[model samples]
Target: MKNMVKRYGFNVEASLPKVPNHPVESKEWLYGRTIINAVRVVMKAQDVQISIFGAENIPATGGALLAINHTGYYDFILGGIPAFVRGKRLVRFMAKKEIFDTPVVGSLMRAMKHVSVNRAAGASSMEDARKHIEAGELVGIFPEATVSRSFEIKELKTGAVRIAESANAPLIPLIIWGGQRIITKDIDRDLGRSHIPVFISVGEPVDTSGDPEVATQRLFEAMRTLLDETRHSYESQYGPFDGGEPWRPVSLGGGAPTLERAKLLEIAEKERRQAKRDAKKAAQAGGRRNPVTALIARLKKLIKK
Candidate 1:
């Protein structure tokens, strides 16, 4: 704890204060959350209900790797209160770039310091998350790479492990149930989806034990346990969850170590392509291309197509 104070600006001598200048509470983002909360309240007035449990385990200090099971965008709302109750402030979340890119919400996401990841790059959002944990800030991550189909849990991603291991952050697995009914892409549905009852539980922090692999494995188990408990707890009230056992964690770093050879080749090819791109940009800016740059381009382009 003392080391955390010196290494990360945490005041271990006292209870951790909510991170001031937290990207999530930036004025723009807070207002946006306010709107969401207001909407939730209105929905609650209409009978939308959400129940949260194990709210105490979340700590007020130190870096935490918040691993969550993905259900939907609104899961943030369903699951947020647990952390808010503990963080005493909002924590940053890594959301798709497009959601934050919208005119109004984009401004909010930016202020909140939510990460914008381009999935096409094949990098899970963990790289973005590691940057936050390294700074001793709190981050929320979903283990499921995408939305759950039918509110049934899905395989977990290695990204959560990567963030915790790479940044050496403590991992916190969050169990979410019944958030699958909030909002929708279907325009025909009323935008004001109200008072959907949700059940949330915050599990114990993963024990890292200074072993990256061990820590990540424990975190993976922790998530599975949380989800299982959530299913059992809510099944009677919310109905049975129609999902299988969650996918194993991909890597201690949130990606498998044994990458496919083709993927590696693709990466190499991408690097060559990028090198050529950089060379071209440089050449264009420099006027005539360099002989070396010209040569490099030929090798990179390999016109197989």
Candidate 2:
């Protein structure tokens, strides 16, 4: 180890810029950051209110999995702002094809190199996500699949966890306190005010390659914690729940505990485990071993007599 170093910060998730060792660093990175900053400036000038937490936990450089709450569609703007101002990293989101069909916004999205996913297509979206993460770009996804209608939060989708594991990246859970998910434009038109408030919060990073299943569960749990924290923030000031109980779907999102997406999660889990085993065997065979493999071997030895 070349004198390894580690640092930590609170009131923010690990939303740091993590551009890997690639030639992509110099090209349009600072430029894109400037664009996002301009967006923030325009938003602030118009009196768009945004509260952000967990601003310092972001890593200096590497890949990361971002799990953001699906509030108003504009929450995308909020999430991207952090990367823009602080991390200086462009975020690649799983956008719908319809967004690309637009005129100006679509052109902007395509120009920025965002990921478009066909949710109706089985595991194809998963495969595309894997490729993007491998490329060392920051990825943000709303694990609820689609934004919820009421105050209710639907079962989270676990693709974020799977991607983190597959790409050996850290998972960052993001929660937005309030915003109009369905009537997103209402807030923008209402002089920076809306029925649902907007406050963005980031949580700590969860290493997914450590143990696929364990890490996935932890990622989901962390998201839930972030949600509770966000919702609680709203209720503390706003008071009285809208009777929106937490709903769930099986095996889909990180901690949903359902079976619908179980097969995919299971398949990914198996691959992660086997990948660790292969790396361990290779290391024992005198090849380089990843830290995950070394950790697993040490754990196994501890469990044995």
lDDT of 2 by residue, 219-303 (tens): 6678777877766675575555444222222212222333434435545766998999998997888756778998999999999
Q: Lowest-scoring 10 consecutive residues by lDDT in candidate 1?
A: 1-10
For candidate 1, the TM-score is: 0.60
Q: Give the TM-score of candidate 2.
A: 0.61
Query: What is the per-residue lDDT of model 1 for residues 1-305, given as tens digits with 9 covering 90 to 100?
Result: 11212102111222333343334443343533565467546645656555656655666656777778775566665555565545344557777766876998888677667777667753656677788778766788776666544343455665677677778777788887655555522112333545455667777877756555565667767877787676666556654444432211122111212234324544676699899999999888887777999888888888743
lDDT of candidate 1 at residue 59, scale 0 to 100: 62
The per-residue C-alpha lDDT of model 2 at residue 10 equals 12
In TM-score terms, which candidate is top? 2
Candidate that scores best on lDDT = 2
Please state the error at residue 27 of candidate 2 in Å. 6.7
